[model samples]
Target: MAQDVLESPLVLLDEVRAGLQGGTMVPYLGPGISALREQEAPMAPEALADFFASKTTLPKRARGNPWAAAQYIESYRFRDTVTLWMQEAFAAPVPPSPFHLWLAGLSLPLIVDTWYAGEMRAALAGQSDWAEVQGITRAGIGEDRWFRFYDEEGTSIDADQAAKARTLLYTPHGCIVPEANFLISDADYVEVLTEIDIQTPIPEEVRQRRTGMSFVFLGCHFHDQLLRTYARQVMKRSSDHHYIVVDPETLTRNERRFLDEQGIIAIDMPLAEAIERLLT
Candidate 1:
């Protein structure tokens, strides 16, 4: 770990804007984006349904607070049914939020995130300019196709269009398409932490687009040990750019010191609000 050599914390957003003006900007997303849009409370995903169910099971005395009870029940237990009920409940074509729109306006050639490919693809497709730029993810082949890491191994090669898609969205957790393959279980997470290197280019492809862009990490928890491995790779591979991370909660002393050591720019603020501030 090396010192960050930070100029100032408050000016991170301005620094990002200036950095982007120099070249394309990459937006790397995390779970917080989905959680926020879903209006999930600050609780673990598995606990939600049970918590709500318990509340709804309350006696008549608690019926006056039916909204809270209903919310708990709906949020907690819906996972089992989301696959079948989400479309009717929330609709599939829901447009991206203002923050997402702003992100697409950057016109970056690459959009890499750890979130589900569907939401981010929807966001990018919603943008006029970005719509022309096909999305390549580990998800599907429509607008966003998976990176097809298997492509690297010489199994599934990319067609001319896929190889040249304006935007390549790679998610380590896998994608929705080709079945629910995104990494979630403990074993899957361990595999991601141990395998997969995004820094190096696959055979025949120009070494994973390294230059001409800055990475803006949003809603990342940095808790995954593998994430640190990725960070280390980026830090070691490049010396010409900076990486920005946004989290509304202020960083802890240890975390700050670690980031400072690594030269990572950590912004203290919620993702949506921070993007708003930067755009303005």
Candidate 2:
């Protein structure tokens, strides 16, 4: 029943920066990070749902819900159709924001990106010490694997090789590059959710890296139940203290409650402003 304290951005700036530099803080990025660049890609679940709706007629109930809209498309049109649309929606290459570039320069052990965009991978292109692991859907794949590891070149690599990297980038929702692996539909999430609570779907390397590490959530909002659940499971067994940059005036009652329950301190500010301060 505790409330998350609204901390002054200036007061926590130094400590947050220090944590990033020391690799004690993991960067948890969301789709909103795409707003840093002027791109045509849908940056949020609602927007993505609209994109699907525009492509094909959707039921009124599925109009604004991405998972439902995607489910409708897969159920009616075909899973391949849904995949093609997803690939087309995120086909445009998004240039990395300054914050992403800055993070790439650091030797952080883990960075969790929940979005499907390849901006993070783009940012790390020049870094040789990093690798990525993305969550794959269980819909079409014949294998029973839940995730796949890739090197800097986008080549598939074993988990052992990924674990040896100095830095690791984890996209729990999948990514566009290398292969178009997306967990957007309800079926995709249902399959993962069944085992996520038991940590069966999470890569072993990610589990080991997240232990005892603090998280800095950038451009993320946990207003939706699905996102809240994923964030909770991903941060499970990690450090108690975490930070999320969000606008105090725009937060819903549920969002505030989620923040409080998770022991996350809220920094009231614009995402761009927060990034500028963090970079400075």
The candidate maximizing TM-score is: 2
How well is each residue in 179-204 modelled by candidate 2, as lDDT tens digits? 98999999999999888999999999
Alpha carbon lDDT of each predicted model: 0.46, 0.88
Q: Model 2 residue 215 lDDT?
A: 91
Error of model 2, residue 186, in angstroms: 0.2
lDDT of 1 by residue, 143-164 (tens): 3332353222123434453446
* Quality of model 1 by C-alpha lDDT: 0.46
Candidate no. 2 TM-score:
0.97
Q: Give the lDDT of residue 31 in candidate 2.
A: 81
Per-candidate TM-score against the hidden true structure: 0.59, 0.97
